[model samples]
Target: MVEEAARRDLAAIAITDHDVVGGIAEAQQAGQRFGVEVVPGIELTAEWDGRLAHILGYFIDPAHPELVVGLERAREQMAAHVRDVLDAARALGVEIDEAALARYRGRYVSGATLVLGMLEQGILRGSPHARQLLLRASREPRPFSAAEAIALIHAAGGVASLAHPVKLRRSEPLLPARTFAPLVAAGLDGIEAWQIVQGPTVRDHYRRVAEALGLVATGGSDCHGPRSVGMRLGTQRVPAAVLSAMKQCWRDRRRALPDRTGSPR
Candidate 1:
């Protein structure tokens, strides 16, 4: 990711892997080598108002004990959920490779990764089949609530932001003020006002919402990987000022609290 950022001439990029911070250290080192800044970040899954919401934590302490413990718990739950998904697939006569699945045991196993693995191993048919399995698996409960996610981010000395609010509900319309109110009250520091998936109008709408609520407006490409189609590095071109604002918010939070032995709580 750092190499790609440098190749794209990006000043900086955040490594917000879902439920994991293991790669941040290496990415940061690569950032130094490549002359690009790497923000230590994590994308956490949380439940809010009976739906799943993704929260992005920026400038986090990757080694924070509390954050590590919480993420470990979440990973365990996700592993169990993957097993349940495999069981469901077997019940439907889909053959799965137990050995291949075992390789993901101690690592972060996202639903998409699992599904794609199955598809690659010929355990699942195609995209439509994978989509069905994902839909079924998504019904499983998340381990953390939105408030807990925000608190965890804060404890890790990071600013919590809502990621791509427009995609939070596919069947429903964009999140209203009432929806964002609870999250903001729970210590959400920003909203993803720009993303590759959202057009200019949608981005403007989220920017307006962020401003109205006094939340920082952030943006990202939401890139999954270098090879991911249609999602490329530096696609959104978020201004440096956005990152500056987030840094200010982080500094303000640290000042409001008492200092600790290590990084501010």
Candidate 2:
């Protein structure tokens, strides 16, 4: 990934691994070796109106104890959700070998992985079937509310942003625009105004709303990994100014605290 980023002329990148910070140190090391800036980040799942919402935390402290604790809790929840899905699959007459699934332990397991596991075992035919089966399961571990998630991100010395507001609406009934105001009131620092998959018009619409609301407009490629999801590194570069502003936001947040020391509590 570092090599690819360098090849593509990306000056910096954020490793916003889902629900975990364990990879940040290695990513930072690679960034150093490859001459690229690595923004420490995490994509946290929060609940709003009983639906799942993704919150992106930029410039976060990887070693923050509170954030660590929160991640552990989230991991447990994810594990439970995975277990439930496996169980549901079994009830549907799809056999699963426990040993095969054991390999994913000690790491954050994605729903996609679980679905793929079933497909590999010939339990499901394709992505569509896997998705439908998982949706039928309807067993998700409760997540932090949006307010709590924003508070946690702030506590971790990170700027909180609503991730892919447009995509988020498709999964749930609540419109992103409708929820933006309440989220801002709850301390949201920004919105993902630009996304690689979104066209210029969609990005512009989000940018306009963010500007109107006085919220920071952030963007990313939303790439999972090198060559994954057809995402080309550096194709959708985040502006240097946006990165500067986010860093400044982190600094200002730190300065606002009564304690001069920024150590994890």
Per-model CA lDDT versus the true structure: 0.83, 0.76
Stretches of candidate 1 above 4 Å error? 98-107, 126-134, 171-173, 260-265
Worst 10 residues of 1 by lDDT: 101-110
Could you tell me every candidate's TM-score relative to the true structure? 0.89, 0.86
Residues 143-235, candidate 2, lDDT per residue (tens digit)? 688888899898888889988887766764224465588899999988887688666877888887778777888989888764245656677
Q: Residues 1-265, candidate 1: write the lDDT tens digits.
A: 7887898999989989888898899999999999998889999989988888999999899899999999999988887887888888787777677667545433456565565567567755654466677676556547799999999999998999999888889865466666699999999999998898888988898998899898999989998774346547898899999989888888888887768323321
- The superposed Cα distance between candidate 2 and the true structure at residue 132, in angstroms, equals 5.9
RMSD of 1: 3.1
The Cα error of candidate 2 at residue 84, in Å, is: 1.7
lDDT of 2: 0.76
TM-score of 2: 0.86
